[model samples]
Target: MRGYWNWLFKGDRPGLYKFFDRWFVFHVLVGASLAMLLPLSLQATASSILLPLASVTVGLSFAWSGSAQVLLQSAEIEQLSSFRVGGIEEYVYTFQTAVLCVLITLVSWCVAGLGVFDLVWPKSSIPCVYGMVCFLLFFMSSVTVRECWHVVVGAQQLLLLRYKVRMDAEKKTNS
Candidate 1:
């Protein structure tokens, strides 16, 4: 926990965004690996459905875990204003993280679809309309989750700023 706190505050310097990108890349790799290696026979339905679902599960799990980490960092930000980290930086990072999550998720679906088709059809990679719709639903889900979290963080920051100003004004009038 202390390590996370230090990373969130002390590590907020410039050039860390590159590190964040790398970190997100690692998660995407995990999702892609899962999409490639998953055995379709394990699922009840056709391999096509099972493979993409499994890959999407893996991607969402990674995104949710990373989001939790960011939420924790945001809490630490609320507590440690003296750290000089700005909310805008946090918001920007959150947006970038969300975008990465969506991209990786889409890639995972693509890889899983290709893998499934390669196994079942052995020649064609083109999926039917149903397959395309399923993938679109998964991509939309990732986007929705990412956007919702950003809105939550932004709202929290606005409320905190408002409260701080109100308290400062009250103190001035009291004095």
Candidate 2:
């Protein structure tokens, strides 16, 4: 438990990048497990109740993950100096990565709706079940969007810090 929490909120340190790389795998495994369960759980019940619960769970997961990401990025920038990697590029890369994820998910949802996933996903028992699956996809999609915003905001904060440091150094040099 201690190690899991540490991996989730890594501190500023030389090995922090390695920490993130390893924990990224852990997070995906957890997320994938949870995501798979939601669809199956929805299949067992009426969407009216299960859908809302799944939606809330998805939202909370995103918020929790996004906060964790912000904390990790903050610690990283503090330790490494965003100027070293060009904060703008980091920001753009983060944004692009997020956008790509969203587009892929959206396309997947559309394809599934058009029966593209029939070869894979089991057929929903009823129209409401289909609706429930769609809702779940949308809810999960919201998580992806928030995660991207998390990256953008995190990088922007680092960029501000980088600018302040540069200005301070200039003042000291001029003096």
Candidate 3:
């Protein structure tokens, strides 16, 4: 866990794949390998265990991506752009985050309603529960996509800073 903490929080430098960990891929393989190690009778529970394990791995990937974005914003990148786009980006991002709150509410409501349904009518919601599980499974993966979106939007901040720096240098030289 300490190793994962470091991997997520500590970045060597900036790049496209800043926090990419091969262990994420390795984990899925490892889980598969571990399943093979188990006998057939216990195999039923193995699949259940693997999904939760993969979810943990997915959560970590999100942690790294989130940490990288936080680091980028907090870094000493000057905000002296002539055309400051930070405010606009933040507005859009804020709205997008608000939408995520709605999604959370919807997912929670569905899970709860389905839970009740399953309780009231045993086995009726078995397929529905499975479907919800699959939805949640991919929902975690969507963090990776959201991370990319954040990075792309955040890159504009860095670009504006770079432009300001270069233009300032040109002005001094010409003067």
Candidate 4:
């Protein structure tokens, strides 16, 4: 579990504070601002958007995972070795990013489910507590979005790498 967490946040990275990077800060700020300004109820948001979004993200993650596995198994390691990039580690990172995105989406979905069920807290009795819950859901949803972005970017990188490898292989054959 610890290794998975590290891979999710620090894949192929050399920093101890990788999880607290710029994107995380941006997500935090945006989430906080949205929580404060958006007057929408958590229940409504969860039932209307977050749940569907989570399902879509989970599907994407699974598809990305399969694609990564296929790419890694099919691509020639020797060809990748010639590239200046991190080689296998790049693909590993993409898989890790997709898995991380799925994890985030699942967690946010659970939180949103609680909101939908009014299981977080009694809204009328403890307004402050409900507010905090809303904030938490918003923050988690924002993080999930960030993770989804990372997964998409990773997918694009993998596609580019595959193209490069194929072109290089064709050049070698022609030569």
Question: lDDT of model 1 at residue 27?
Answer: 42
* Top-TM-score structure, candidate number: 4
Cα lDDT tens digits for candidate 3, 29-147: 44445434433322243344445544543454344436434534542333432244433333234323433433453443344344543354333346445434433433433433444
Off by over 4 Å in 4: 1-19, 77-90, 115-132
From the highest lDDT down, the ranking of the candidates is 4, 2, 1, 3
Could you give candidate 2's per-residue lDDT for residues 95-147 as a string of tens digits?
A: 44454455555555555545544434444445445444545554545555455
Q: Report the poorest 10 consecutive residues by lDDT, candidate 1.
A: 38-47
TM-score list, all predictions: 0.34, 0.41, 0.31, 0.68
lDDT against the true structure, per candidate, is 0.47, 0.48, 0.42, 0.64
Model with the higher lDDT, candidate 3 or 4: 4
Q: What number of clashing residue pairs does each candidate have, in the order they appear?
A: 0, 0, 0, 0
What is candidate 4's TM-score against the reference?
0.68
Residue-level lDDT of model 4, residues 1-175, one tens digit each, is 1354554455466323444677777777776786677676666667677557767777776676677667666556435745745456555654675566568556665666656435646567776777776666666667666566666666666677778878888999999
- Model 3 local distance difference test score: 0.42
Span of 10 residues, lowest total lDDT, candidate 3: 38-47
Residue pairs with backbone overlap in model 4:
none
